[model samples]
Target: MSSISNRIEQISSSKPGAKDYINYLHSLSAAADLISYAKAIIQIPDGAIVARPVLAEFVSYTKGLADAREEVLIATLDVLKEKTIIFEEQEFLAREALAEVYEQKNEFTKAARVLQGMRLDSGQQHITDDQKVAVYVRIVRMLLEDEDDAGAETYLNKCALLIHKCNDPAQKVHFKLSQARIFDTRRKFLDATRKYYEMSLEEAVDADDRLQCLLAASKTAILSPAGPLRQRVLTALYKDERSVQLPTFKVLEQLYENRILDQEDVKQFAEMLEPHQLALMGDGVTVLHRAVLEHNLLAISRVFSCISFPRVAALLGMELTQAEDTIANMIIQGRLSGRIDQVSGFVYFDSEKSNLNVRQKALVRLDEVAERIAATSRDVRIY
Candidate 1:
């Protein structure tokens, strides 16, 4: 310990050459003296020579030194692992430095793991709320970068618990953005759209960020199941004067107007959505395709009081059986106030009943369309 401790003092007081200090640390690392080296640094006094700043400088110096950079970081982390109870700042910085190495290498999940390795809830360290929030936010972002929403969510939950206590606007925005992203990835389009829309309205977030959030809002809104609840979010986005500038604005308008979305239109809008948003559902059709098909059926209901199954299938560009099934589902869910005349191969719509609360009254022959809309993925925007 005295060896490294005296060397740190020598370097700290004299500002020794980078080569000399780096070479010495490299030697210690090569000799497997990691524990001693780390302890020497942690053992430094806090009053005249604080552990926080000195540990930060030590970690900073090791970065980009090529051969021993990551090795030194890991060594420091190992030494401080169980001692975070006392050397919390040193351990945090050590882990952060190692995580940065992983980040630079594009190993996002590994970076997130290294960051979350800290025992934030152990209560042994005096880590402030802001510090904990910062760590949680970083872990969430890194996990998101890897497209691991479930993992990201675990950390975001920790942030949510303390977000109100956080004073930094940037961190708060990060927490909101991560939450919205998780909502989106999990196919909760309506909830995601609402969060993104809310973030867009925040002046605290810069214009580009706000614009991206608005675009995300519109995309999620378009992807949302065609329903009155989703329409509210779509309407709000379309009415946002600033939304007019977005390419997604037109799709949002179409969704708001309940107009049938064409294949070309869906294709264009699908271009902006994430792969998961376009992921195939159990029905062997993409989510966007499913949403568009249902939306078109809703449009059809508005125009025709009664439509033949063949005509509905032709209009929806799908098989007659699929059209019948889709319409039967809408009717049963009370999303469309209609009944299927299986014998006549036609669907009859009730304009008045369509306006009534779904649970207020069950339409005629509810069991005739016995197939219930599967609750396969409730994490989706619409329940």
Candidate 2:
């Protein structure tokens, strides 16, 4: 205990050329054992202020020298494993050093403790609110990426509290919007929608913030289940003074595609929309139709590939019977001219007209007509 206590005091005092001493210790065969000893200093009883400072000193010394990786690792382990009194002692700089080394080693829990230490030290003169917010957001995002939602949510709530302290109302709203978006990503759709709705209402009262809020609320509505909630959000969007430039078109087309609204509803929505909105709808429809054609064409094309027909159809979520019928119909229409391989049951598209019989030729002609219709529909911008 005396030797360990002396080493801790030497670390705390950081004598001249102290880095050399740490290197010398690292070179010792007993360096790992010394690290364990430093860890025990941190674990010493609560009223042991002298011991805590010594442990902190040792940590500081190790932090200043890269050769102290073993010591730093052991200190970090004490925080997680030994329930050492890091939080109460204000040994943040020591914890920060430990976190840096652990983070370099891809040890997230130790890195997270750096944030916790900062949180404990947050009211100190040096740690500003902005710095605290930055740390909270970083740690929360890391936890989120690791799928530790509970931990992330705790930090996010802390971030939200700090954001609420911002003097600018707009900045506060921005933070709230960000909070809502994070919740949305976690599939807490109702919470997201509620926050978005409140923001939209509040911002709509201010003409300058209205458009920004409309865009946010529109996105929230799109994610929500089709019901009064979505309708309410849409209604709020439409009521905004800048609603003319808002995203009504894409939302309507998306709703139509999802079968949440019918053709008559689409027509009504188009009529209610501005010219730019109508143009946007036309663009969405064109893209949708092209996607559908590509999906079908790609499915048919794959039948000629080495892949099994049923396997391709199953992947496309089409019934094997429907796939067969569709292929046969395409052959008859002359859009596709191919004989089904007897062994593989795969259709091979033929380029030569002479290769097609009378029924096949007629079918190919019909397919040409259908392709023309599809192309015309895709090219026309009715909006």
Q: Report the C-alpha lDDT of model 1 over 69-96, residue by residue, as the tens digit.
A: 7777887887676556776766777788
Model 2 misplaced stretches (Cα beyond 4 Å)? 1-90, 96-110, 113-139, 154-178, 193-220, 234-383
Query: Following a full C-alpha superposition, what root-mean-square deviation does model 1 have from the true structure?
Result: 10.0
Model 2 global lDDT (CA atoms, 0 to 1):
0.54
User: All candidates' TM-scores?
Assistant: 0.81, 0.37
**Cα distance off (Å), candidate 2, residue 357:** 62
- Deviation (Å) of 326 in candidate 1: 1.6
lDDT of residue 381 for candidate 2: 92
Prediction 1 TM-score vs. true: 0.81
> Per-residue error at 42 for model 2, in Å?
8.5
lDDT tens digits by residue: candidate 2, 1-383:
46765664565554424343445345433445556555545544433444545544555556545666646555544553444343334355555666677667776765775657554553533566665676676676556545566787888888877875555565455556556656655555546766766776674247556555555555445444433234455565555566557645454344433332333434544444223222322324322222232234333453444445686466545567656765666556544446566487766665443545576568889999999999999998966
Give the clashing residue pairs of candidate 1, or none.
187-380, 188-381, 189-381
